[model samples]
Target: MEARLIPIALTIAGSDSGGGAGIQADLKAFSALGVYGASVITALTAQNTRAVTMVEPASCAMIAAQMQAVFDDLEIRAVKLGMLGDAQAIATVAAGLRGRDVPVVLDPVMVAKSGDRLLPTDALTALRTELLPLATVLTPNLPEAADLLDTAPACDEDRILEQGQALCELGAQAVLMKGGHGRGPECVDLLIRANGVTRLSAPRRATQNTHGTGCTLSAAIAAGLAQGMDLTQAVTRAHAYLQGAIAHADGLGVGSGHGPVHHFHGIWPNG
Candidate 1:
């Protein structure tokens, strides 16, 4: 038999001990979407569904070594970046990825679901100057987008559209303004590229198990891109996948607080 080859997608992020978000979620989503997953963990958090108790960041040398190990061997088609803890980590990641032609989906993960600060205040400057320009698509929730633009969070559709455009003008190739934090019965994600803006809306499923939704969505988008899909097609498929996962979120009965969406929902029965 001929040797099998697979598309590889990379996730550079922190570790969620809870397994619902960060590197764990990214890996799971990558597998479920039929893409090979590689990871470079920037930080590790002692966290569960309720809160993050502690965080430990990796050294710049270690981070660079890991990225080099992967890049030297594997053909990484796309990358999803999340939870860069501080200025130094962000700078290291940016330097490692600066000239790569791979599609980078940057999830400006500043805060955790439990309301813990994942990215430091001083790091925002590095994120904007060093990282944002490297992204093929930037995914930011309302609060993150607001912080990135130094404006109040958008509460309505029009404001969110404006924010997306502003972010695109900040040098990111494209922007996906996530509306999960918006007040609505539907989740509206706006995709703004050079062509135009496309709104992806799905009925919001009521579930506390939405802890990893953002990470999963961005990872899935990267997976699609790795599979050679266009930006709009990848975003559309990612939105559908996320909606399905949210609708079938597992009630694993593991934690007392927010649970997690089933990454393998399509493969497993009754997720």
Candidate 2:
């Protein structure tokens, strides 16, 4: 019998005890998308659908050791970055990724779905300075984009593109400006690269169970990249996958406040 190889993606992020976002969501997305997942937990959050009550960041040494441990043996084809807790953690991750040749999906996860602060306001500068320059894809929602730029969220298409350009100028190889927080019947996501910007829009889904959306999307993209998809191809597939997940989120009946999307919606019948 011949040996079989599997595409593997790495996730460096926090852990949500709620099992909705962070490392749990990332691993689920990877598995759902047919990629093997490895994780390095940077922080641990006491959170559920309703709120984030407490957070504990891992030590810098442990973070570095985990990254080394993963890269040393595993054939990590892509990386999905989520909630890096502090400036030191960001620096540690950036240092670890400085010379890697894998595709990197940086989610810039600043806040939770419940409006709780995940990354401190003081850590934004560190993230922008160290990580953005090395990111293969930077996925930021309206508020996250605004936080990165230290400005107000864009209310229209033109401003959104303008901010997207501003982020590109800041060193993100490509920016996927997410519009989940925008108003209207349709949600727009712009894939802004050096060549041009491609628009991907889908009708706004009316699901209160949209927790961990950003993490899932980026992780799906990493999974696609691990499976050898281009940026546009991966983003397109991830966008559609997220739509399906959100569309069927309410079926799960997970929590009371905001619930989680079904990462296995495609695999399971009627989720």
Candidate 3:
């Protein structure tokens, strides 16, 4: 009997030296979900739970070359995009993924864990114009959605649905506006499509290990899609997986702000 090979998912994002977000978190999520993870680092950040002190972006050509090398050898079933730090990097990644008809989960990571800006103000237009249209699903938090739409909607369920719809008009096939930042007992994630809005509500875990929550969620969804799950099912499973990770966060003392969730909670005891 021959052993089946796990499908691969490519994460084109930045490197978080803290291991809390970006490529590190993405790869961890993919591994936890039983997928082989590959990455093309777009930028490197000197960051931790405290704040991002510095960021060094890779050249656009180098970034594109990395993507080419991976796609040439690996059968990447899905792609999760995180922080493309600049307009050039965004355009480069967008061009590279243009012809690849794989499920692409776009986590518009505009802000860092410490509330510092990751995606530059100038890059927002490039991301919206060049990348969002190519995404299979666009996952943005409330602030990100508001930035994309140029208006702040109330954190209510109805407003979230409306915001999701508005985001869809920006060229995404589907929009998942995360409500974790919203003030509520339930972490409501609104999914808007041509069919209508579907609200996925999970009980909010009272934990500070949320640094990589967005990155992990997007990666998990990409893994699910790589394994052939539909959009709704993928999002559902991703949410559950993230909830578990949040509940079992590693008590790694570092800074005063939020820390990293334990991505390998179920797979590895001490991870």
lDDT of each candidate versus the true structure: 0.93, 0.95, 0.90
TM-score-sorted candidate list, best first: 2, 1, 3
Please tell me which predicted candidate would have the highest lDDT against the true structure.
Answer: 2
Q: Which pairs of residues collide in model 3?
A: none
Candidate 1 worst ten-residue window by lDDT: 247-256
Local accuracy of candidate 1 as per-residue lDDT tens digits, 1-271: 9987899999999999999999999999999999999999999999999999999999999999999999999999999999988999999999999888899999999999999999888899999999889999999999999999988999999999999999998889999999999876888999998889999998877778888889999999999999999999999999999888888885455487888888888898871
Question: Alpha-carbon error at 73 in model 1, in Å?
Answer: 0.7
Better of 2 and 3 by lDDT: 2
Clashing pairs in 1: none
Per-residue lDDT value at 115 in model 3: 88
Per residue, candidate 3 scores C-alpha lDDT tens digits across 165-211 of 87788899999989988987888998889897777888887887789
Q: Work out the TM-score per prediction.
A: 0.98, 0.99, 0.96
Best by TM-score: 2
Q: List, residue by residue over 86-203, the lDDT tens digit for candidate 2.
A: 9999999999999889999999999899999888899999999999999999999999999999999999999999999999999999999999999999999999999999999999
Task: Note the residue pairs that clash in candidate 2.
Answer: none
Off by over 4 Å in 2: none
Question: Which candidate would rank higher by lDDT, 1 or 2?
Answer: 2
TM-score of 1: 0.98
